[model samples]
Target: MSDVDQSQLFEFLCRMGDNTLVLGHRVSEWCGHAPVLEEDIALANTALDLIGQTQMWLGLAGEVEDKSRSADDLAMLRDVWDFRNVLLVEQPNGDFGQTMMRQFLFDAWHLAMLKALTGSCDDRIAAIAAKSVKEVQYHVERSGDTVVGLGDGTSESHRRMQKALDLLWPYVGEMFVADAVDEAMAKAGVAPDPATLRDAFDARVEAVLTDATLTIPDGGFAHKGGKTGFQHSEHLGHLLTQMQWLQRAYPGATW
Candidate 1:
């Protein structure tokens, strides 16, 4: 691969790893605080799965860049602006319904992405996707069921779910907006084209929304950036401060 191609692939891998790591951290915050014990366990497991995937993806990213940095270095040392996670994952988790809505939306896209990637020409990516897709399947099932139940339940539950959906829909756009790196990766069969996943993602989302008795919002503005390692929601900096404090304060300290 050319230097430019390797650079783009590195950026693409960073984006994937960063998204999972940040979202896992966000979900991990729900530990011991979920509405019930079962949910607490469930969220923690999901968070663990995401973070585990981060190790593999970011480990490969470091190798691709020929950098001596480890995955721990990438995860713990990067500044907020250096993260390439989509805006959706970094959005503040609100009520229970909001968190599920966010998870459901992401799981839908994530599953599609991983499934496509299982066939990637890049063997490492294909291997990772094959393993991770099973975990994402469970994530989708859990979050999708929660979405439908809350959306179709009591009037208040229904209202809250709808509100969460509307609030989150705007950020969903960023997941599908392909840039140069995305185009390059797709050309190399190292990644799937985000555009190609749109139709299936829309259908899957619509099926859940229909069953949930929820209406898709009309004409909300879409948020972008985060893939560029430049723009982020204000929440990311705060999240990083909490997440990176120990590493920054005590670099190279080992258990």
Candidate 2:
């Protein structure tokens, strides 16, 4: 492979890993804080699943980069700017309703991406995608169910669900925008172009939102920069501070 292909593949792997890592941390914040015991346990389990996926993706990323860095080193030692998660996952979990809304949206997109990856020419990539897709299948089901419950249950719940949808809609666009890394991955048959996932994503979203009685906002204004590492929200820095503190403060400390 050419240097450019290798670099882009490493980047693609990091993008996959960082998405799960950041979002896993965000979901973990709901532990003990969820509305009820059942929800609390469910969210925690979901977080664990995502974190487990992160280890594999980032572990492969480390190898592909030919760097000595392990997954822990990449996840805990990197600054906010080094992260390549899409903007959607890193957005704060606003409230139970909002969090579920965010989860449903991302789960829909994530499942599509993973399914596409199952057909990847690269055996390793296909293997991860096959394994990860099973977990995300359940994730999308749970999150989509929650969204429908809230959106169609009561006037108050419906309002909050709609509001969350509007608030998060912009970030959704970034996931489908093909960039240079996407181009390389597509060329290498490592993965499909990001735009190709949009149709599946939109179909799932539309079906769920329709059942939920929610309205998607009208606009094409997408917030970029998160996955590209060109920029991130102020929240990412704050999140990194909390997430990396243990490693940063006690450098090389073991669990």
TM-scores, each model vs. reference: 0.97, 0.98
Off by over 4 Å in 1: 1-4
Candidate whose lDDT is highest: 2
Per-candidate Cα lDDT values, in order, are: 0.92, 0.94
lDDT of 2 by residue, 1-255 (tens): 343487889999999999999999999999999999999999999999999999999999999888798999899999988999998999999989999998998999999999999998888889999999999999999999999999999999999999999999999999999998999888878899999999999999999999999999998999999999999988888889889999889999996
lDDT of 2 at 5: 80
* TM-score of structure candidate 2: 0.98
Name the runs in model 2 displaced over 4 angstroms: 1-4
Q: Residue 16, candidate 2: how far off, in angstroms?
A: 0.2
Q: Candidate 1, 186: how far from true, in Å? A: 0.9
